[model samples]
Structure formats: structure tokens, C-alpha cells
Target: MAGFFSRSVRATADEDAGSDEAPLRPIAASDAVRRVELLDSFEAAGLGWFWATDAQGRLIYLSDNASEKLGWSDGEAIGKPLGELFIPERFDDPNKTQRPLVFLLSARNSISGLNVRLAFTKEEVWWEIAGKPQFDEKGRFTGYRGSARDVTASRESDLNAERVAQFDPLTGLANRERLTTRLTETLTSYRNSKRACALLTLDLDRFKQITDTMGQQGGDELLKQVAARLEQIVDSEGEIGHLGGGKFQIVQPDVDDRGALGELGQRLIQALSQPYSIDGARAIIGASIGVAIAPYDGLDTKELVTAADLALYAAKGGGRGQYRFYSSDLKNSVQERRRVEEDLRDAIANGQISMHYQPVVCAKTYKVQSCEALMRWDHPENGDVPPAVFIPVAEDIGIIREMGEWALNEVCRQAKQWPVELRVAVNVSPMQFAHDDFAQTVRNALTNSGLDAARLELEITENVFLGDIGRAQGMFAELKELGVNLALDDFGSGYSSLSYLRTASFDTIKIDQGFVRGATEEGNNNAAILTAIVGLADALGMETVAEGVEARDELELVTQRGATLVQGFIFARPMPNEDFVDRLANGQQTYEARGPAKYRAARKTVFRRIGLIHEDNRYKVVMRNLSKTGAMIEGLLEVPLGTQVVLDLGGGQLAVATVRRSKGALQGVEFENPLISDGAEGLCTRHRVSPYQIEAAGRPLAALPQDPYSLIMGEQEGAGSPRQFVEVEVGTPKPGTGY
Candidate 1:
């Protein structure tokens, strides 16, 4: 019967259009009989068959199965639109057709009735149908036929699956997948405009701590609340995209300037700052945002996203609850830094890196007391690589520990060869501190080098304690116990106004060069800051040193501001070990004292000269200065305290004096007796020593002094005997004051 109905509709469609069409093929007797049998079988299978008129918009045929399925008799549904049979009038437009259902059937050829839903007398019911329009042999328009099945429960289940995929299970915001779709489309639309957009990437600060302690379910609930708040904030401005697990990316098109972008970042941070009501519990979460402007920081989607991610890292690094604008240089530097990191890893393994020592001078004394060990890599191909370049690279690549250990070993090895009184300061990378055996490693370095622990200074930055504070404290304490001097390097560079002196057990603080570089900027405020830092150091019982002194004025300024130690190019550039020692020795040669001859107040006093004392108690003395009656002596050791000793003032008369004290290699003695009497002529005749005039020989001449002992140890030794050694008494404390 359904087949006959389909054939009649097609023949009528051809006649109405007045188109010549081929006659329908005669139905096979077996097929005609089978059609009836198949329709009956479908009824028994609980499926419904129906037909709607192409023009009349009426249901012309209905199977007995549908009446039974819908609990209605066949006569009740015949001649009426199927929509009217099951659906209420209020839910229908009498003149309107089911265009969506009709289009799906016509275009798709067949559609599932399970996907069809409508209000039926205000009651919901689902039906699945398979329908296709029949056509005459010549392909003229015809009628439709299909099977329908009720599937309201299955339809609802399928819809739930789709909803779960599009929305986040926890927050119910667009999940990463959906966010990616929206982002792609948004970017594509903006692609042709050439206008810049901004991507603000945010991550909750310390979210892991909350998640770790609260359990997964609790963490998820908190995240849901966070997402809801974020949704509310961006609902008016733009779309909110969830990047999953506490990360989000808010994209705004047509950003004006950095200020506006920064403002937006701040707004997001502010919104996240409020306490969230999650699962009946109040929770607080801190957030950091990094904003990257399109076409400025990056032009492409990936580049922009990466820049924003980097900026986000920078924000979190700077300190939580803040924001940083992405810069082109940041991206460029990150790329270049990655390259340098690769170079650093190779350099460490290949021994291409070397250490240079920069002397840290005592500002008042003008003496090279300590040499800071700075790493300098002279790549065979690259030449001199700046410390600034490779240091950061090494730090980033995790090979910093290897490089730092190399630095420590090299510093200690070369430092052992220098004058024993001079100390070596090595900069320890933060990676060194984080090493599980950092303290043990340092101890091993000291033990292996045979260098005194007190003479070895390890420099650390304030950020070294940022991660695992307790571990940092414990490691620092252990290092301190080994007698290594601890200096806080770049003291004011990190989060400042910290009483690190009181909290961290640091023995010294090296004022960042940035402050000192402008210390003498024509009465700049930097002078005050430098002075305050020095005073603070003094108050805390810690020594202060200034770095990056490039000019004489800056040097003088720091000295006057009470900076006891200073390191910079003005004094000496960091040099190789040999050159550093040579520079020190040369500096000691031409430097002169500021006081009048034989007076106590001297600008440049020989603090100490430490060396292995010869077995022979009597040693040669070299007079750095000479007078008729007295001389200032430079020797390897100090005379025993208060011991009167005779000096062969060379070329004759013996002078005797009492040793006052020893300061390193310099000894102070009070003249007990001058071998020569009054006038130069009388002194020369009695002492059998010629009174050489100042200009007569290529050496210093003796002159009689009111203070006779002034010439006691004043004879210059020209023989070069014990050339490197200066003679004086042993066991004097003053000469070794610093040691």
C-alpha cells in the first residue's frame, strides 16, 4: 500500500508540472506481495510507517503500528498533519511546515527519528525516522516514505555527551578544546584587519599548595569557583578561555597601548583576589597575569601565546599578584638565551671556560685584599664571551652546578698560589646551593685545595633562598660551619628592604653595582642610598663592598661614604691569574705614602707580607724608605713583640730598635740606639758609613733626623739577595692583623 501511494504521488507530480516522464515500471508480483508482507512485518516489529502529502501538508497514510505505539486509533491520525496528532496547538503554527525535519529528510536523504523532538500537548516525546523522497523513472519530484521509532531517552543521553565535551566538568566554562576553537575563529577574523590584539595569560600563584593539601575534589571545587568569577569578569569584555588546571588565556582585540593592557591585567588580578566560596568553604587564591600585545610582542598566534606564557613566568617570578607586559626583547633574548645555553653546556664539558680574578680593594688602604673569582669564557671561535651572557645561560641550562663547581675549584687552586693573606671570593650560582650535596661539595673543595676556609669566600644571591626556604637555610648554615665567608651578592637587586642581615647568616653584603655606578652622579640621590647601605651594614656588624666602580669620582665617593671595599674597572679589570698577581705587585711598587717622613700617619702603610719564613732567624731587609737615622722596613714576618733587635743598616753602623708590632709583612720598631751621632760628617766618620747624598748614587741617601731611629732599618738592599723576601722579627701580631 505504501509503495502504491509513493507511485501515485510521483505520477501526479509529473502531470502537475506537465513534464513528459517515463512510465513507472510495473511492480513485480512477488515484490508487490512482499511489500505488503514487509509492511506487516514492520508493524509486528513495533515500527511505524507514515506518509505526508507533498502539497496538502497532511498525513495521508498511517500504519496501525503507530496508533498502537502512540495508544491512539488509526482513524484519529489519518488526514491530519502528524504534528497536530501528537503536539498541542499552542506549540504549532498551523500554516508552517516542519522545515528542519523536512530539509533533513530531503537533504540528508534519511534522518533518525531519535533526533526529532517537539512539544506534544506540552508533553515531551522523541521519534526516530528514516525517510527519502521517491521519484518517477524520469527523476520527477515525488513523495516520501520512512520508518519512525520513539527514542526520547536515547536522544537525551546523546545530548548529555555533547554537553560534557564542550564544557569543563568542574568549572562548566568552555574547556580547552572549545576554547581553542573559539580562539582560532576569533584570530582568523582579526587576521585581515591587521589590528593588534592582546593575550593575557594567567596562572594562580601557589595553587599547587592548595591542591596538595585539600585533595583533588576540593581543589576541583575551588577551581570551579575561580572559573565562575573569571567568567563574570570577562562576560562583558570578551570571551573567557580556560586552558585547563588553573590556567586561562583572555584575548582582547584592539588594545590601545601598554597602559590599557596593563590595566586589564590588573583588573583580572583584582577579580581573582577576592575570596571564593567553593564547596561550602572559603578559599583564597593569588594570581599572576602576563600580557602580550599582538603585532608588537608577536604577530602569529603561537608566538603571541608563547610570549604571553613567558611573561606570565616573569610575573610569577617577579612575585605573585603582579603582571608584566611582554616585550620583543624578551622574546628575542629568550631565543638567544636558549642558544647560549647550548653553548654553555658544551663549554663546561670541553674546558673552554676559564676564571679571572678581580681585586676587591680596601678603599682606605688602597690594597688588594681579596680577589673575586669571575668566570670568563674565551670560546676558541667566539673569542671573549661576556660573563653577563654566559652566566645567565649557564643558570638556565641546569649545568650551572657543573660550571659553579669548576669556578670554585679553579678559584681555590690559583688562590693558593697568591700571597696567603689575600682571600678569594667565588660567586656560587644558585644551582650550587640547591644541589643535594652542596655543603659537602664546598667542604671537599676546601679540603682538596689545602686553602684556609677563612680565606675562601662564597658569594650567593638573595634569590637563592626563594625555593624551599628551609633547605636554603639549612644549606647556608652548614656552609657557614665550614668557616667559609658568606657574602650576599647583588644585595639590593631582588625584593628589597629585607633585613637579610638579621635573618640570613651572611657575613657581608656586596652592594649591587647599579647603585654605585651612579654614586657620584653630581650629587645624585644614589650617594645617599650608598651611604645608607654602608651604615646599615655597619649597624648589622657586616662588611660592605661596592661593585662596578668605573670612574675615579665614583671610587672616591664610595670611600668617603664609608664603603670599606670596592671592586670595579677603575681599580683593575678582572684579569687572568698571572696578570692579576702582576698587577698587584706593580701597584705596590709605585704607590707612595701620604704622610711626612718619619711621621705615624701614613696614607699607604704596608699592612702585611705573609710568606714561608726561612729557618734562619736572621733575614735580609729591604728599605722601601730610608733616612740617616731610621727607615721603614718591608719584611716577610714581624719581630717578636717588644724585642729589641739589631739591624745591619747595610754599609756600616748598626742600629738597634724594639719591635712594636707586626702587620702582615710590615714590622714597626722604635729605635733604641742610633749608631751615628749628630751631624752627617760626624756620623759618617764615626759609623764608617759614607753619607751618600740623595742624588749622588742610584740609591737613597741617608739623612740625619731629629728622631734618630728613623734610619734604623732604612738601608736599601741593592744586591737582590733574598730579593722577594724582606727581613724583620717573627711573631709580631700587627703584620698579620687581617689574617
Candidate 2:
């Protein structure tokens, strides 16, 4: 080390040493001792340290102070490579722009402002180093000399500031800006390979009510709890970003399978809906998620985010606590919903809203004992709008409170004309039930109608059990005091808590239609579930009503399971109040079960155009009806049975099916694999055509472009092989008529 230090005492030292004169010391020989002292003082004061390396880039000299800092004793680091002393870290670089120390050394280039980690430190030690290559008067490579100072503290502060810029302060999750940058980069890079990614936009339900009542501090705490739960749920599969307030976004790269996405969306909804402990008080909130997959829903971050936001609007508009996948039609749904909201404000004034009744017959006798009141809206331009469609819209527009009050008063007024032996049940919205004056409103309705309180039944769903459990019990008690039967509606479907039955004095339990839908099918647990619910109700001395028994088999199963009352289409579709009154006046007491004797796979009646592919040809056909397993198509003449074909349901979904039955211009084709929900209102396949296939077919890789199938199958028409079936033009099926 000492000999190496003398190797460069003077630039011309090498030449001078061989001459007759001794070496010409650059600092005058008298000051040479003082120069060494000054350098020693710099090290002792911890201002900086000096290092020199041999021509081979091996460390020849390191100041004693620096050696001690590295826990090295007496020249232990003397022969190590200079690069070995500063290991480049994969950790955040204060400025993401720095050449590697080794690269600079190997190139014999000057290095400056380079940040590197100390290779052998117990804790991270960063250094900002600068070095210049040494050479003799002849421009030959010599090793280097450099000064280094500890920059760990300042680097940490810079990194912390960078983290602050990227993360949400309250939740410690990535902020929207960071997530947007990540999404943009992912989509841009994946465009060439056509990889799929799904983004989920979610926000808390009932969050506004919390903020209004609990204040911002309470709301912030709830948001924190939600963020923690999301971290636990998402783990490493994706990144979560806090989009401020109660909203959040998630980016899952390389994921587009609808089934998995749907499952994860549902898991998020359920987990977020669970009770949260805020400030030592229990609060309940829910989440609604909207999912958009890249290359399908949208091609870029802006398109994808807009699609996801639209889907979220649809989800919240459909009903809170649900998830919906983005579809092109959802573009119009938002505008339509806005119109619905505007029209609904005038509905009450224009008498557009009306109440109808459906009979609930005794399960054993089939005698009509109670009739549930249902709200229906008949639009002046659109005609009758189903309650399922407009009710959610009404709820979102905040008109449900007014609508509920009107319905309660009208139901009571109408019940006054009915026989006292018969009861009238009205469904109550959870939002309406949560209001402070709900019980008082009920009292006013009963008093004004002059109807016996016992004849009015209020159906309250278990969702009302969310938030303020003690308050819910108090409301239940107040309603019980009015002598109206309080039925626990949609049992076993929501907030499935036995504690509800234990705490509240409910008069009856209405078994959810979901359990009865496929209860009679072989290997289904719904039947067992129905039986268990009835037994529990019986043990609790509460009457049970089975809802939505649409078939004779469904009715028989619920009756056998000891359900006290049955309400569904098999009894009778909801009828106008005048008709209901006429039927009772004319002695129509019992409703005979008239549906199909045995349950078949439930088929949704659909009337829409779809592509039918056979051989190398595609024909347009009307899908008359669809089920998970099969679909019936029209507009094809004399289709032979046992023929395999594909149904192009759009969005890159191609279902392979075989003709199971055939009639003139109509055929029933059974799918080889059952269809899954598209995470909204439709069915879609689990897989879509890969972009790789499109690229292989002589097309550029891009987001899903329409008519990609045409490329896959070659040109559609204009020449080719002979056609098979005759294409028959079919008109739209008239309402209430079978094809």
C-alpha cells in the first residue's frame, strides 16, 4: 500500500526517478509532510475518504477511517476489486439514472455522482462517489483515485419523498397516479403480445351515509380498514390503488378469464361488506366492483378506465353491493338510467306508479291466505317497466323513500277493502327501514287507512341488519307493537346470520327464491337447505313462506319441506288490484298449481340475432331461448339432428354445440360445455380467441378487433364451398306467442 501511494506522487515521477536528478516532488518536498497531515485530518474529521486502485482496478489504498467504517482492520480491503466495494443494489435508485460502478471502471471512464451500496455492511450504506482515471505523461491507463462521502441519510429521505409521491398517505397503498402509470405501461407493452389484463374499480356502498352521520374522521378510519382488508385479500396477485375517498382501483396483469375475475370480484364484495370496527363501534359497509378486461372492453388505459367506470355505474345502479363487467351496451345504459331518474321524479305526480298483488297460498291447502303487494311503473312512452328494473333505479335516485311511503299507505288503503282473514304483505327497502321515522310512518299509514293493523304485513330483508344492530332491534320492536306481521324476507340469501333470528322477534321467515329455483334437481343441496330452514322456523315458532315456486315440482318440494305458505308463478302471476278484488268477490279462493309437472333446466327467453357456424359457412339465426347447457335457435330450415356447429355469441365467444332436436326453421342445440355468466346479465365463454391466432392469420397484433372470426375462418362469402341448410327469414316472435 505504501509503495503504491508513491507510484503517483508526481506525474513525471517515473521519468525523474530514472534521471540523474531525484524525483521532482509536485508539492515541494518541504510541504509533502504537511500534505499528508492535511489528508489525514480530512479522514479524521469524517468529511470524506480517499481511495486509490492499481492498474488492475484492485484496491491498493483505503483511508483508515473508511476501513473502520466497513468493519475492516489494517489493510484487509487492500487487494479487493474496487467494484466489489460498491455493490449495485436492485433497490430504488435515488435517481434511476446511473451507470454501474463496474461499467465505469472497466471503460476507464471518469465517474461522478454515482450512488452505490457498500458490499459488506450490516446495514445499507450508500455513497456518492467520483473518480478520474490516472495516467502518466504518456496517455496510458493507470488505476483511479476517488473521494466518497456517506449519502445514506439523504438518499433515504429522497426515497421516502418518492414513496410519498406514489402512495396514499392515509392507507399507505399506491395512489391513482402511480396505478395509472402502471396500467398505461402494462397495456402498452402487452399490446404486441395481446396479453389480457383486467381492471376492477370499486367503491364502498353506504359510505355517504356514514360520512353524513359519523363525520370525516370516522369515514377515514373505515377507509383504512377497507384498505387493510384489500391488502390481505389481493396479496401478490395485483396492485391496489386508493383513488381517494372510498374508491379504489386494482390492476391485475396477465388476467382476463371472466370466471376468475368474477370470483375475485365477489370475494371483494363480500369481504368489504363485512362489519368494520371503527373507533370501537361496529359499522357495516359494502363494495361494488366494475371489471373491464383489456383488448375486449377497451384497448388502452383511458378506454379501459372509462369502460370500468361505466360498468361501476351500472353496478351501483343495478343495486349496491354487486359487481358488473363492462359491455358495449352499458354505454347506453348510463344515459337510459339518467332518463329513468328524471322520469321517476314525475311518476308519482302523473300516477305512473301502481301497486299490484300476487297471491301467497297455504302450502297444504293451496288456499290463498295472503297476497304480497308489488310496485309497478308504467312509463308513458315505454309502457310497463318491471319492478326489478326500475326499483333499483328508483333506489339510486333517492326516490325510494317517497316511493316506499306511497306504497305503504296505498297497500294499507287497499287492504281496508279486503277480508280481514286475508293479509297484505309489502316489501320494505333497507334504505327506507334505516330512516328514523320509518316506524312512525307505518303508524300513520295504519291510522289513516282504517284497516286492521293485523291485516298488514311488512316484509323486511336481512340486509337491514347491516349497521347499527341495536337500532335495528329497536325498530323491529316498534313494528311488532303495531301488530303487523314482520316477515324476515330473502332468508338464507343475505347477511346469513342466525343471530338475526335470535335477536329480533320476527313473525315469519320468507325462504329466498334462490334456494327454491333448483331445489328439486338431483344432487342439489337446495332441497336440504329448504328443509333445514323450515325446521329452524318451526323450532323458533315462526311461520315460513317459500317464495318463487314457479313449477309444480318446486311447489311440491317446498310443501313437503313444511313451508307454511307458497308464493310464486305457479300460484298466479301478480294481477291488477281490481282483478284481484273481482276474483275474491266471485269466490276464487284456491289457486291450483298449473305449471309444468316436473322441473326442466331453466331457460331464459331471449330474442336476438346470433351467428350460427356450420362447416365453413356462417348463418344469421335468432336465439329464441338460452340456458347454461343449451340454446334454441330459429331461422335455419331442416337442420338435421346430431350435427355439430358453433354459435358466435359475439365478444369472441364461440360455443360448440350439437343439434339435439330439430323443427322446421327451428333447432335446439346443446352446448358441449355449460356457459358461465359474463359477470353481468349475460353468458360468455371462459376463454376468448387469443391474439396469437389472429396474428398467425396474417393480421397485426392488437386489441380485439371486430370480425377477427372472419379472418380465422377465411373470407365469409362471395364464393367457396356449397352451403348446407337453407336460410329462412324469420320475423320477430309476437309477444305471448310460442314460435
Candidate 3:
């Protein structure tokens, strides 16, 4: 047997010795003999092999087991470089420099470990390699030692765990965590550039309803279908992520084209709107998309998501199944609505809601034919709030009826001051008309203001008929009896019928702007519908007012279709009472004669009446109803202030008239016809009755009441006693005038 120290070699470090590289004590020959014997014993253990290489590419030593592992005898491996058998790339620098094992030599030398997986002797086996520096007795550079083991089973287990974490198990795409990480990265990049991206937060509308009807598994199947569709839509231009549950997020990066985004959003909406067959049960689910654009809406991942969520809420609130852009203004609208709710409650108590006048002009003549009564809120702190923002809020709080009443009263009061030809139209909220007292309210408004019932036009939308039609009919009949003109606003857009027009007591049907705006398009469907609607209204004996006449072509088309009145930007936007008054004054100075076809061309052949008066200095008028051949005069004032007077009838049927007598507005006038036929009795009998009859009709003519002061308030609750309205004539100045 060999002694432990007999075969051991002495180690020495000729290089500078650092504390980490201290010299090792020399082993006795007996210890060396024992070390060799121990290495020989390990070689037989079959636990794999160990090899050592010097800092140079030289193999310093090898365990006896290396020969068995590599199928080579120890003598065959002793002189070769270890990397030749293991590492694919060897350090062949002239300096022999390497990392980790380079400084372990007195001469130029180095050692490096090979990092690789290998099947050295058998293709079925895998191994991991680890190498370290070895030293001699004096801590001088000697070699490096390496060891490796097969770790395929452990690594495979860890890899499976990682895959489970990073991917959606159902779709094999990035899961919520991975998607969120990508979102964070995307947001980080966007933050530096101030560029924009749109984050689409999509949730299937009616999903809960579907899920309830279908089982949870069915819902899962539907979600899988949605995911597949989303993947196809995203393609390579954008990225989409499943946000767990049924929600998903699509990020469109570096998108400058808004049209492209809109198109994409529409496509997504359509795609997600399709029905899915789940377990042979066909169920349709639509998506409500909320898009939040970066830079415009938010700067960070969280903020974008939040804005998207708010947009989603808005979409869902707006009847769902639609997409909406993230807008702070819309959010501000909501907050403003809250304030309006509070203000409306206070308004009801303190009566702060008032009415403002906006003149509606005739498109052809640019004359203020009517004025729409618009609501205005005077908040002590906020100043005047627009009706667009607060009206809906008022409707929500059930106070619009009171507000409507106030509007009617204000309109009636203001109408008394307007030119006799101009009408006052007040919009009646649906809530206002829903009550049984709506008709009574209008009657009271007329009675209180002393406004001519014919001049007060009440405007209601098609939906107003939905509330108790029988009651509405009764109220409408009562309103008709009071001589108030009733207009069904936005008419062609709803469930409009000839029977409704004939039986509902509506005097006018205001065609919706949507139809009228497109009426001029020759081949457009809207144009055809507009033509038909106008024809239908005319046939039903209801006058039509075409709204939104923005183009001359549209106005021409509507006029051709026999639209009795037209109002839009093509004419003029609404203006105040004073402005309308000024317009009328200017119109009087420069009279523009209307064409015969446009003035009063209703097929019914009712006479178009205009009162021409010559007044005295007090401006009291001797009124005359001019006929085709003659004039019937009734004098309230002895002489009308204006020296010349003209009657405008369609077909240029103007008749010049002079004041004959004035007995407190029992004025008499004689006509000098210029447009009608030459024979006086022939013209009178042909048109209708004679001048004597027309004069007799004005016999009880008292002085026309003065126009009342303009009371601009929203609908007022409770009944008010009727007040006398002092009508103010424009040509004559009246004392103690109030407005």
C-alpha cells in the first residue's frame, strides 16, 4: 500500500502573492500518493468526471474518471488542451489572457470555463458545466477545475412555470401581467416624445345578460372568439392584450391619422358586434369601446386607462353598444350637469331661469318672421348658462314644466311687442306637454299676456305624442280652439303619420334638419324622403317649415316641395328682440316685395291679408284691408303716420291705400289697385265678397291694445291673473313704455 504523502507534489507561486493567493504548504510524497489513490477511488464512483486546465490552454491534470467518461485512457488526455474536448471557442490571444482563471501563473497562462449544455457520450443525457481556478502549494498558477451535471429535469420544470405565468392559458398570448408590463413600456416611450397613442378599452355590451342566460363555460367560449377576432384586427400595426375577465385593451402606437383610428374603431365595433356560436347556442354580443388618446387625454399608463374607462362608462350610459372618445369636456359636461341639477332646484325656488329671444328669419327675404324663446339661466356666481347644458338637466329634475310655463308667458309677453306679422314660437319640453295642464298653461299664458292666440306658436317634438295620446289630443284641440299655432318639431324623423296630422290639431310640421339638409342632393335617399314628406304634409293640409336650409339648392328644393316656411343658417341664426325689431324697422324703410309663389301659395286659396295704414303724428293707424280691386277701411287713428302704404300679397298684388277716417282706430281706407284686375266690382266678386263687406268687418274696430312689456322668464308654476298688454306700435311713440 502507498503512504498518503508519498505521491503528493509540492506547490509554489513565483508570482506576487496577494492575501487571496497565499502559498499552500508542501504535501509529503506519502500524502501525494494518498491523493492519487483517493482520485482513483472517485474515478470508479461513476458520478461523472472532473478536469483541470492551466491558465494557458494546456490541460494541467485530469481525474482518472475523465478517461472512462470520454472513453479515453488518462494517458491519451494528459497533454491536450481541455477546451478542445469541451468549449467550442478557445482563447488564443498571444498574451494568453482570460477572465476568472487568468492570473494563476508564473508564465503567460490563462483558463476559462465552458458554459454550455452537452450530450457528450450519449444523446439522451444532458449536463451543466461549472469551472474554477486551482492552485499549487505556493498559490502559483497551475490550472482550472471544472464540474458538470445533467440538470434537464430541473430546468424543464422551471421553464414550464415561467410559461404559465407569462401567457394566457386559453389564447397563448400575453396574459394580464405581461400585457401590463408592455403597456408600461409603451407608455414610458410615449412619455419622452409627447406623441399620441389610443388605448381602446373594450367590454362586450350585454355580456352580463348573455352570461346569465348562458353558462360560465359558454361565456368563456365567447371570450375566446372575441380574442381571436381581436388578434386578426390588431395584425402587426398595433397590439392588443387581454385584461383578464371579459375586458380587453388595444394600444395603437404612433398613430397621427385620426381617420385611420376612427376606421379602426368602427371595424372593431363591427367585428365585436357579430354573434358567436357557443356550444351550438348562437349568442350575439356587441362591444362598447372607450378610446383614450395619449397626449390629448393622458400622459401615463394609468391615466390613459382611467380616461378610457370613463369613456367606456359614457358609451355604456348612452345606451351601450357604441364607442366614445375620451374627452375631458364631456366629463366637464357631467360635472356641469350636477351643478345644473343643484341650480335648477334653486331656480325653481328663486325663479332665476329666464327667457331670451332669438329671431328666426325668412331665408329669401332675410326678414325676422318669428322669434324662438330660448331659456337662459342667470346664476348669481356663474353668470348666464347656456340652455344646451342645463335644459337636459332641468328635464331630468322634473322642473321643465314650470320652466316651460314661464317660457310661454315670456313668449306671449314679448310677442305683443313684435311686428304683427312676426310670430313667437316657444319650444315645449316633453315634460311640459306630458302634464294634463299643459293646454291650460298655454291658455293662461295667452290670457295673461293679452297676446293674440294666433301669434303664439307652441313647438313640440314627435315624442310628445307618446304620452297619453288621447289626453294630448284633447289638449291639442283646446289649444287649437285658443288659436295657438301648433308645430310638430323634427317631424319626418319619428313616427309621423297623415292621420296624426289630420287629427292632432297641429297647424305646422317642422321637417327635421337631417332630412332638409340633404334634400338638395339629387340622388340622395334623404332628398327623396324630404320631397315625399313635404308632399305628404301639404296633402294633409298642414303647413311645413323646412329647417336647416343651409344651401340655396336645399332652399329651392324645399320651396319647390311647397314648404310654407324655411329657417336655418342660410337665413340667419337667432337674434334678440331688439335686433329683430331693428331688422323690421330696416325692412320697412326698404321694402322687399315677396314673390307670389312664396308668399301665401297654399292650394286652399285663402286670401293673404296685410294691413296698410297711413297714421297721424300720434301714429294712430287708419287700417285698410286691401283687395284685388278695392280697399275696406277702418280708422282707429285719423291719419296713419306713414305717408305711403303698400299691401304685399303673393303675385305682386300690391294695393295703394289712403286713410279716409280715424275714430279711435275705426279707420277707413280707399285702395288704388296696381296689381289686381282693372274692373273694380269684377275683381271684388271674383276674389270673394266686396269692399263694403270688408269695411263692415272693421266697424267695431277699437284702438289696437299696446304691446305688453317683455317678461323673459322660464315657465312659472301656479296660475297668474290675466294682465292687459299695451301693444307698442313702431311708427308711433307711446308714453310710459315698459319692456
Q: Across residues 1-739, which tens digit of lDDT does each residue of candidate 2 receive? A: 2422342434443345676677445666587654665565676688888888989999888877788889998889898999988887563322245678889999999988788899899899998888999998898887999888899999999989978999999999999998998888888877766678899999888787677656789889889989999999999889999999889999988998888888899999889877777766567778889998887777789999999999898888766678888866788987788788888899889998888999999999999989999998888778887665678777777889999999999989987886435899999998899899999999999999988889888998766765567788999999989888888898877556787899988889999998999899989999999989999999999999999988888988998889999999987999988989888988898888889988787688899898888887899999999998999999999999999999988767789999999989999999998887755556777777765677778877655554568766666442567888899998977554210
Candidate 3 — which residues are off by over 4 angstroms?
1-309, 312-323, 328-335, 340-354, 358-369, 377-384, 419-421, 494-499, 518-525, 551-553, 582-739
Q: Which candidate leads in TM-score? A: 2
Off by over 4 Å in 1: 1-194, 200-252, 256-292, 295-300, 306-342, 496-499, 517-527, 587-739
Output the TM-score of candidate 3.
0.40
Q: Which stretch of 10 consecutive residues in model 3 shows the poorest summed lDDT?
A: 704-713
Model 3 sits at a Cα RMSD from the real structure of: 26.4
Q: What is the clash count for each candidate, in the order shown?
A: 24, 0, 54
Worst 10 residues of 1 by lDDT: 677-686
TM-score, model 1 to reference: 0.47
State model 3's lDDT.
0.59
Q: State the displacement of the C-alpha of residue 591, model 2, in Å, after optimal TM-score superposition.
A: 2.4
Residue lDDT tens for model 3, 1-739: 2212223322222233457767574646776544664554454475645665665657655555545556666467677765555423233221243332222223333333333333256643334555666677898756666655445576677758976987777765567786676677776766555455778888876565456556677777778888899989888777777777778888788763444565677788778765566765556566777777665456667777888888776565454556766545445545655666776777745767666655555535655566567776777767766565466556546676777777788778877766555677889876677667777888888888888888888888655554235666787887888888888888865345555676787777788987865454456687677778778877778777887666666667777766777776555655555766676766642223233222211122122234342221112222234444334433233444333544333121234555454444344444564222211111221121121222234422111111100011113211243312122342322332110
lDDT of 1: 0.62
State model 2's lDDT. 0.84
